[model samples]
Target: MKLNVYADKMSQPSRAVVFFCKVNGIDYEEIKVHIPKGQHLTPEFEGILFFFLFDEAINLMQKLPAIADGRFKLFESHAILIYLACAFPGVADHWYPADVFKRSKIHSVLDWHHSNLRRGAAPYVFNTTIAPILGRPLNPQAAAEAEIILSSSLSKLESFWLKGNGRFLLGGNQPSIADLSLVCELMQLEVLDEKDRTRLLGPHKKVQQWIENTRNATNPHFDEVHRVIMLAKERQQHQRLKAAKNEGGSNMKKPLVSRM
Candidate 1:
């Protein structure tokens, strides 16, 4: 049985998992779980649709980027990326690498990502932009707090993981799952208004270069997986403009027009 990757492109981790699969040429089917529509709340049991109703089922997964490889079921994007790198035959070595020491370092980076960087990046984007789209009021105080953490996290990456002479994280010439995951997380900031986005990301020069390098390494596949977020950004911008015209200069959170 081919691998089935259930994911929502809008999700940061989900995009990383999907992009990893696509970049490595893993044979898999993408099962989209559209979160904005609440599809994740009622996921269909793939390959066994009628085995049990979604309401009655006790063990059915309820998350983006869950996967079923034959009988093996897995969630969590980092685990999925590592699994694909090790499970697939044609995956490049630099992704996870064979050296235990190097792999351990990669693990360290991933650990740090969730503990530190993600704490700020995810919520900052959520409170600042995604909140209004979800019919929730924007939380400037929370966004402000998250920005401080996000900026600090970027500085750590610059001084530590990205300190060496190489382009990628830990001074490596190639991209790894850590790089992919972290970069994808940062992509959430793309939806921010230009001034805010620049203010947060501009000062980290090494981090900026590393993002570009990883992006180029993954290329078409990287951008392909990220198309949804970019689309969301475009739609939000258009909505703002139309809202301005229609509302006659009222500065309020206009509803995010559904262009997905």
Candidate 2:
């Protein structure tokens, strides 16, 4: 039976799952769930067991990047990646190595990512880019705190994880699922203004190189999965420019009206 994946490419986990499927040649049907439109809230989605929902109001226990094969279902991107690696024949070992120690190291990075890198990175991007676009209240204090945490997380990512003389995370020459997961999380920052994105990522040369390396390793599949995000970022930039131009025009007209 073919696998069914319900995902939105705008989401990091969803992109990761899509990338994995494409790179590994896994046969799956892509079901696009438009989160902004509230499609996931409908009865059709709710009927599915283990549906990967991505609402902030939902409990944290709910999983995302979910998959289904027949009646069986699974969620949690990390678990799903490992499952794919293990279940599918001909999957490369570097993804989820059979060696107990190597596998444990990969597990360690994945576990650490949630609370550290993901916590800092995802919130920062949401606060800076998505919140403003959605007309949600922007919390400067929260964004500031998230940036500090994100900076520290990047430091650790550089000084510890990628410190060894290896191209990828955990000192592996090839990219692993952990690399994909974390890279996708960091990629969220791309939606920010170019200045902010550059400031946040500039100091971390190694991290930047690792991201490039991972993309190269995954090849056309990585870029293909990321097309949605790339388009979104472009649209965001256009919107910002338009808004600024309107603001400037309004400011200029206000003086003329006041003088009259």
Candidate 3:
């Protein structure tokens, strides 16, 4: 069965799915949920009638039995990743393990994703960036407080989770879903201004090193994920340079006027 993923460009969950598929050589088709265009909110894309039941899209998946059968199928990311790893043996060893304890450890990462990381980080970043662009201004104080909380959590993750005595998150051999989930979340830090990136990710040398390593690695895809990130970063820098030039030009005019 071809895995179908519904995602927006900047979404961390979506990126994790894409990264996993690419790294594992899993075949899938993507259905874009372009939040900027208000596409995710549409009946065609977001409607429970059209797709699987996720926590965010649970109501929509209620009607489709073929898609909603809890037996012989799983919709949650952790469940799906485990299912995929077991089904595709040649994929990789680091993702999920046959060992019961090792497998349970991997599942814990997913559980943490829903409760801690998503709760702490996702909303703060979304409200800070996407909300305003979508015409909703979340309270500034709430956003700031959320960032601090999220950053603190990130610091702990750096010290303990991502840096957990392995070359990757699962252990020293390679990476697993745990690594992907953490990396995907770290990718969101790139959206912040320079100061925020330094404050949030810079102090975590291991986390920063892993991210740099992944960006340098290869993935089999028509469009690789990090390539898109690099292009976006370059574009943002260009815009900043243009704005600086205009400000400089205005300052030059003021000096000339004063001389006159």
Candidate 4:
């Protein structure tokens, strides 16, 4: 199976895919899609999107239908994750537990991720961390609202999700899908300002340690992952600053920059 990933190295979902691929020692060609350049909106992307209109990760999903002529198109990072876990069962047991109760527990974590953590936390990361770098600070009210939600969500994860000592989520055992989602989300939080850092990752020792552990999972690749994630965030921040300058020069109404 040829796995062609169209991803911006800086995107969290893309980073998750990269993390998954590295963990599995999977050989694949990574096609960089420059989100900052708006390459995702290009004609080629439009064509790919048209093929898989229902799926945001169209470029990768569309290939399955074309190559095998089966119901192969897939979308959503979570869905792709489940499919990969089932398809490559031997690679890593952490993503999909074999035990029935463990699997159910993992599903619960994923469901929680979709409804709570992802919903609450992602907007803050996007608005403050990415959008500012993209020439726009988020709307004042929206950013404030997102930060509130993110704080509460972070608190919940630290207080409840990390209750055990198994090295990751799932009640003190090895990492499961829950841990993966949490790790990816935490990666976004690492780019935040002091207040957010304190509100999100500061008090969460487990989450903090998990981040450190994932960084050095494999000798050679550990440093690579750290380098890639940090570089991506820095580049995005720089771009946002440049965009902010351009926006100011253009006299666009700027949202008052404030940290909650």
- For each candidate, the alpha-carbon lDDT, in order, equals 0.84, 0.83, 0.63, 0.64
lDDT of 1 at 17: 90
Residue-wise C-alpha lDDT for candidate 4, range 1-260, written one tens digit per residue: 56655566556566566566677776655666677766676777656655644444455432211111123645456666666677664667756877798888778877888777777677877776667557776675776788787777777777777666656676644555556556776677656654666766677676677666555554355445546667765776677689889988899766798887
Worst 10 residues of 1 by lDDT: 50-59
Query: How many steric clashes does model 4 contain?
Result: 3
Q: Which of 2 and 3 is ahead in lDDT?
A: 2
Query: Candidates' TM-scores?
Result: 0.87, 0.90, 0.77, 0.75
What does the lDDT come to for candidate 3?
A: 0.63
Query: Per-residue alpha-carbon lDDT of model 1 for 93-208, expressed as tens digits?
Result: 99999999999999999999988899999999999889876678999999999988999998999899999799899899999999999999998888888888899889899988
The candidate, 2 or 3, that scores higher on TM-score is 2
Model 1 regions more than 4 Å off: 43-61, 243-260
Model 4's alpha-carbon lDDT is 0.64
Q: Which stretches of candidate 3 lie over 4 Å from their true place?
A: 46-74, 163-165, 216-223, 242-260
Write one digit per residue (lDDT tens) for candidate 3, span 1-260. 56655555466666676777777777766655666666655676556423454444532432211112332433555555666677766777767877789878778777876776667677776665546656888667877777777877777667766665556665545667777766776676565556766876767788777765555453443137655555655665676689899998887744335544
The alpha-carbon lDDT assigned to residue 18 of candidate 4 equals: 58
Residues 27-144, candidate 2, lDDT per residue (tens digit)? 9998777666555666555644334443222212444577776655677888889988998887899989999999999999999998899888878888877876556877778888
Q: Order the candidates by lDDT, highest first — what do you get?
A: 1, 2, 4, 3
* Candidate of highest TM-score: 2
Off by over 4 Å in 2: 48-62, 132-135, 253-260
lDDT of 3 at 233: 58
Deviation in Å, model 4, residue 123 alpha carbon: 1.3
